[model samples]
Target chain A: MKKLIFIFVLLIFSFSYAYQFYGIPYLQQVNDFSLINQDGKKIKFSDFKGKYLLVFFGYTYCPDVCPTSMLRISDVLDELGDYKKYVKVLFISVDPERDTPKALKKFISFYDKTGKYIVGLTGKPEDIKKVAKQFRAFYQKVPVKNKEVGYLVDHSAYIYLVDPKGIIRMIYRPDNDDPKRIAEDIKQIIKMFGTGE
Target chain B: MKKFIIFLLTGFIFLAYGNEIIIKDPWIRAVPPSSKNTALFMTIVNKSDKQDTLISVKTDIAKIVMIHKTVEENGIMKMKHVDSLSIPPHSEVKLKPGGLHIMIMGLKRPIKEGEEVKINLFFKNSGNIEILAPVLRR
Candidate 1:
């Protein structure tokens, strides 16, 4: 009886460990909020209802991780190919004080010159804080000794994949997740959810 | 004639005992027209028997340049300033994306793709080395 029980426990643990999605499964309905986009237009969470939303929290001043994440996202979109039409990438700035709409526009244009695929968003600090809390994203401004650079913002760099129905379905580490795998995951989610269109 | 011979001999000796630090594939991240910051990536190989430390970096494209390392703790990515990076003897140190990098801030002008930028790197024992790095998106 003890041997049988141990076997059953091991099977249960293995079953639980096996996840369906390539990214970490995070199934929840994301709260809706409003923030200003790079075009200086107020965009609400509901505005992206019919498309899969790839949300990332970062700042424009981030030279290493932020740009790397952006490039990864661009590659993922490229991998999506025809499916890219049903997806949108959102880069939310945690440092709203320095990331004005104009600055955000210029920074995002570097990745997407047409400015049609990726959207850079920034708003009031408290409003950004609320939105960050909704996604459980953390960011803090740490002052540096250098007078020219002023300060740096340390932030979480996870890419959240929200389904077309406004439900958070998966999360990816920008530094670790492969673009092809992420693209396949998005396709799987689309096939299962029917794009919610 | 004696002084000339001595000078030539000293020149030959100095050439034979010079620093053996080699830099490869150095490139700077290209930024948008209005952006003010970028990062540089490269691989430094020290062929000499003695270790050397990279002390400072200077560039005319940006007002401030510093060595920074991107560290991830508790799922948060943070950039930390590194005073110097030491390259071990007969080993190579990489400064790449999502790792060690040279952070350049307060750009005097936009760095577009396909352009070349000159940078001066000062080493503890290797002295000053100049490199022209191409601006690339990667």
Candidate 2:
């Protein structure tokens, strides 16, 4: 009788975990890159061996979209409650000139005040271009009249969702940044991969 | 005849109460289908003599309407929620891109180019006012 009860609960758990939230739709491999964090410490994408990644490419000058999406992302992590252990968010800056180590640290500070598990990186334009091209990013400078320094940046806004093996798994667009819904989706993906979160 | 004359007089009084602020152009920019945020901008002009402030704003399209200011300090732009902005008597305040604007959070869904968003602005003295915010492609 005891053995039968255990089997019954297992059946129910697996049934509830069948739907996956995010994974590679085209079955493309994830791009690997070497980048430096706010502390100027050398880190590679492969260093994150056992967690999913939510990646975004934009500059700190973005007055509206960038910060708002970041706030929602942080909130989604909060919605994870405890599953935050299974995910990582990488904020890569395409604006290499301005988003220096110190600047990246301060910009990310507003959204992630606690700063437990968030990473910000800035590098040379060529390096950024290589990484961006690998992930299919298009960036350009929008000139403002009579402004001597710093212009608006026009770039892709899609947020990429990468898998644990560092493979291209799925892309989470910020278009409908519903934190609860996205969090639930992420939780589902983790469960599908047998994390049971 | 006496009752009809009184009714006409009341109607005329209501029509002449033109103290409300008229929002000329309003808009929320479009983003990809997965983003949860968008920004709103409009030009408001107070036609009355008494001073007023934008107390609160509402949109059928968003979950929260936060008035925001883009402050430039040390050559860097920062976004923060603002309580309200004052409009002196008969002055026009322009809320546009790269400056003072409304921050719309928790969108119901992704907006498209050329779509119109209905916004209602509430004033401390002028009561309720309405405007149409058209989407701007950027």
For all predicted structures, in order, the TM-scores are: 0.89, 0.58
- Candidate 1's error at A63, in angstroms? 1.1
lDDT of 2 by residue, A18-42 (tens): 7544422323455678887878887
Reported per model, the fraction of native interface contacts reproduced equals 0.78, 0.03
Residue A185 of candidate 2: its Cα lDDT? 70
**Candidate 2: stretches off by over 4 Å:** A1-26, A146-149, A195-197, B1-19, B22-138
For all predictions in the order shown, the interface RMSD in Å is 1.2, 12.4
**Candidate 2 displacement at residue B28 in angstroms:** 14
Total backbone clashes of model 1? 0
Report the lDDT of model 2 for residue B83. Answer: 89
**DockQ for each model:** 0.75, 0.06
lDDT of 2 by residue, B44-101 (tens): 8887766779988999877767787765443234555688978887788988655688
Question: Which one is best on DockQ?
Answer: 1
Give Cα-based local distance difference scores for all models.
0.87, 0.70
CAPRI docking class of candidate 1: medium
